[model samples]
Target: MPEGLTDDGLAAMLVRGLRPTRVTLVEHDPRWADRFGARAAELRRVLGERARLVEHVGSTSVPGLAAKPIVDIVVGIDDPDDEQAYLPDLEAIGYDLRVRESQHRCLRAGDPDEPVNLHCYPPEHAETRKYLVFRDRLRSSPEDRERYESVKRDLAQREWRDVNFYAEAKGPVIREILARGGWTD
Candidate 1:
């Protein structure tokens, strides 16, 4: 676990159930970029200067990779744990708080056909940059991208007790890609 975040703290982050469910990965959608762009614009309009950085990360951000069809965005804020600063600001624009971790928060919104997840983190958070780097690496390196896609495609076929478990299953592959991608400037 991350510093200051205990095991209990991690478990408490879930705002809802972790029932068994399967995620279906779909073909790369060209419109995901536009969807992310629109959301980023809306977030900027609402948060203004407080929105330090808004980026499109996750499988959807990669051009040819298959994904869950949800747009995952990372917003760098002054402080993620300070809900008063951005939680309501984002909620005002229709985002619902889903996860509140030690140094991060996740908000979800959008129609059922295409949901959006906003990950909020401090401007200096390593996870925020980690997301961007992983995304960029996949975008540029077809070899790693294909390898990730294969793993995701295989994992997507299994019925997961929790979506987090599915994510955990991808750890080895993600780490391999991240190793090739590097972690620092």
Candidate 2:
């Protein structure tokens, strides 16, 4: 339904599966760290050396920040575009490839009840560095973390057709915080 996506393309995407719509923000949970560690271990076990680097990114990784319950993780591989090399192993471990882009692949684990976002990017990708730096910046800076949490709380009050839309809406603030932290695109 979004602009630039034709009816056929929209239908195909819908057929693939609709993303969960609930966008509730909850207080930071210490268990999120454990969840990330568990998922990281599984990814490492499955991909072995192919998983060049695995890290916990996004708001969930930041302590004391309100965020959607889903755990966000970034997995760096040799080549993200080469699905043949890692897709099967990831799929075997319950990750369903959802968004396949030129530079990255966004995979999902678990059903609508409990979900995880596994972002796969090639090593040295700017997005990978951005995710790491943004996460670290948020974790280390209380002022930025509070600002992000305020933005998220305000956004959570509105209605969203898809949960991802809410995430996209936070981009400007995220970029501002990243800039304050000296993160360049």
Candidate 3:
């Protein structure tokens, strides 16, 4: 059984049948910009000042990258574990706590009705903000963006029981780009 999957039997059962969607590289879409802007506004309205450093990060944030069509938003705060400070407000906004991996000092919320991934992290953690930096880097650098797109395309084609493993597979290239961008994580 691969790491991170709760059901080893399920993983074994699905491996033979799983296949990834084909990759598509598109020009920057204006609609993505509009969707992000609207969602950010809503997030700020609900979380108020606690919505610190809300950013549109992930493949969708980067122009011309093939993605799973989910909008990834990063919510940075003073403390991620302190539920009293932000969790209630976020829950009010309709985000469900789908996963909590304190080992990573992070938690993931999901909106099953809507395709969105809300990642909560502490502001003090630089690695947490690296996602934003990476998005920016790819948006501005065509070379880096192309490389990342290629890596993503290849990785997506592989059979993986756990989504986390697919994410981890991109670590090396991501770290290399971060190093080039003078970011240490």
Better candidate number, 1 or 2, judged by TM-score = 1
Q: State the lDDT of candidate 1 residue by residue for 84-125, as single tens digits.
A: 987887888789988877788888999999899999988778
Model 1 spans with C-alpha error above 4 angstroms: 1-10
What are the per-residue Cα lDDT tens digits for candidate 3 across 18-69? 3343433344555666677877888888888886777888888887877766
In model 1, the worst 10-residue window by lDDT is 1-10
**Per-residue lDDT for 8-43 in model 2, tens only?**
454454426445465688899999899999999999
Each candidate's TM vs. the true structure?
Answer: 0.92, 0.88, 0.78
User: How would the candidate models be sorted by TM-score, starting from the highest?
Assistant: 1, 2, 3
- Please give the clash total of every predicted structure, in order: 0, 0, 0
For each candidate, the alpha-carbon lDDT, in order, equals 0.86, 0.82, 0.67
Q: Which scores greater on lDDT, model 2 or model 3?
A: 2
Clashes of 2: 0
lDDT of 1 at 74: 92
117 Cα displacement, candidate 2 (Å): 0.8
Q: How close is candidate 2 to the true structure, as a TM-score?
A: 0.88
Best-matching candidate per lDDT = 1
